[model samples]
Target: MTAKAERMASLPSSLPPFGVGRLKAAALFDISPSLFDRLVESRQLPQPRLLGGRLVWDVSELGDAWRSLPHRLEDIDGFTTTGNPWDE
Candidate 1:
């Protein structure tokens, strides 16, 4: 094979199409695994499905949960706001 082909082959492929393990799931959200677990426990994120005894989180479900999260805002005084700001 050519050098270019060899280099291309050496590169890692993208994430799987549907599901991912705990570490990859955490990486996807740019959070630590422990944080990911917390989110799951708090129902901020969807729980993983059991695939042959291995836990697998569905990418689509994760995306949906992430989008459903409430947006947070911080003012100049270091004050933070939760829930719908427009409701105030």
Candidate 2:
């Protein structure tokens, strides 16, 4: 690969809302589509824009949400953390 190609490959994939699908989002988060539905129902997830009858989420906003999930630790038995990493 050329230097430019290698550089691009090393960078994170930036997917705009128009290109993102619900299934792709769920897969990336290791969750089910039902969970995504709940997030949407509860308004926790980013509002999907209607583009040609397809629902999509903004990657930048979704990235922020993914980070917030770890921070908002509730009562999930599987997730183990010190509650707040900055609470030390």
Candidate 3:
């Protein structure tokens, strides 16, 4: 299996692959629910699915998204100011 899949499979059952809400995601990131939606809209975070009007995301995707934050910000900064941060 892929690394993400393997890691996801090993997470505690309390956090399954999907079906998470803004409240739970906020708790995971220690942010407010409203802020979480803003982050999502800004593309600073992953966009979860909607189930019956409830926003949800897989724990695995959330974990990956969390880990990618720094990289994403770096890329944005590089693109905006340097044309390419890794162009050294």
Candidate 4:
């Protein structure tokens, strides 16, 4: 293989499948941390696990939740254009 191809092959396939703290989770959804808190409180999102004295949401679980969201925001109960990543 060419040098570029070999280098690409040596890179990791994807990010590690692990838990993320609150800010990271919110950043993933492109929502404010406060909104993330609300989602958790309202049960719109799964409760994060408390690990080693820190709260963390499973990355895979978060990805699954994102995939499960309604294709159209209108279908969601209180989805708004405000703070929406799609709007950016």
Candidate 5:
């Protein structure tokens, strides 16, 4: 299995299959919370759903989205001079 698959498999199976909270999802992606936010803002990540008053991302959906990221997505990161999405 790939490293990402191994990491995903390591998550507790006891949790709901709909997946984890934002913080946990960021950790699972091996990205900082800020970067996760940026990805979401750029529509590179899947939209989250509200569950029991808390936002949660589906594991299957997240995995699929991560695998689908464009190769140039990383290259654009360095060219973005502004970190604030509101300014865009």
Candidate 6:
């Protein structure tokens, strides 16, 4: 194989394409398609954009939305729970 072919073969194959369909978008988030739809409806995720007459999710937008999701308090650093509220 030529050097260019070798370099191309060495590139990561699992990287997502620029834009993806509904199913692919769901798979990217590791969630069911229905749940993906619910998230979209709830405005937790951005709506897909029209590309070449096809509705497709932009991977960068998905990434931004994922980063914007709320994180649990426990997941945050310097967080501590005093007493269990359930005990009150």
Top lDDT prediction, candidate number: 4
Question: For model 1, what is the alpha-carbon lDDT of residue 31?
Answer: 98
Candidate 4 local lDDT, 9-61, one digit each (tens):
88788857488889989999999999999998998887899998989999898
Give the per-residue lDDT digits (tens) of candidate 1, residues 1-88.
Answer: 9996896577677644588899989998999999999999998799999999999999999889777665656442445565648878
- Tens digits of per-residue lDDT for model 3 on 19-57? 577788878899998998899899888888877776688
lDDT of 6 at 55: 89
Off by over 4 Å in 2: 1-18, 72-88
For candidate 1, give the lDDT of residue 84.
48
Clashes of each: 0, 0, 1, 0, 0, 0
lDDT of 6 by residue, 1-88 (tens): 9996896588788864677899989998999999999999998898999988988999999999888765654533454444558757
Best TM-score among the predictions, by candidate number: 4
* Per-prediction CA RMSD (Å): 8.4, 9.8, 10.0, 9.9, 10.1, 7.1
Instruction: Give the clash total for candidate 6.
Output: 0
Ranking by TM-score: 4, 1, 6, 5, 3, 2
For model 6, the local distance difference test gives 0.84
Best-to-worst lDDT order: 4, 6, 1, 5, 3, 2
lDDT of each: 0.84, 0.73, 0.77, 0.85, 0.81, 0.84
TM-score of each: 0.64, 0.56, 0.56, 0.65, 0.59, 0.63
Q: For candidate 1, list the clashing residue pairs, or say none.
A: none
Which of the two, 2 or 4, has more TM-score? Answer: 4
Off by over 4 Å in 5: 1-16, 70-88
Model 6: residue 18 alpha-carbon error in angstroms: 1.3
Tens digits of per-residue lDDT, candidate 5, 1-88, equal 9997898798897855667788988997899999998988888898888888888888999989878765643545456544648776
**Residue 65 deviation, candidate 6, in Å?**
0.6
Check candidate 6 and list the clashing pairs.
none
Query: Which candidate would rank higher by lDDT, 2 or 6?
Result: 6
Clashing pairs in 4: none
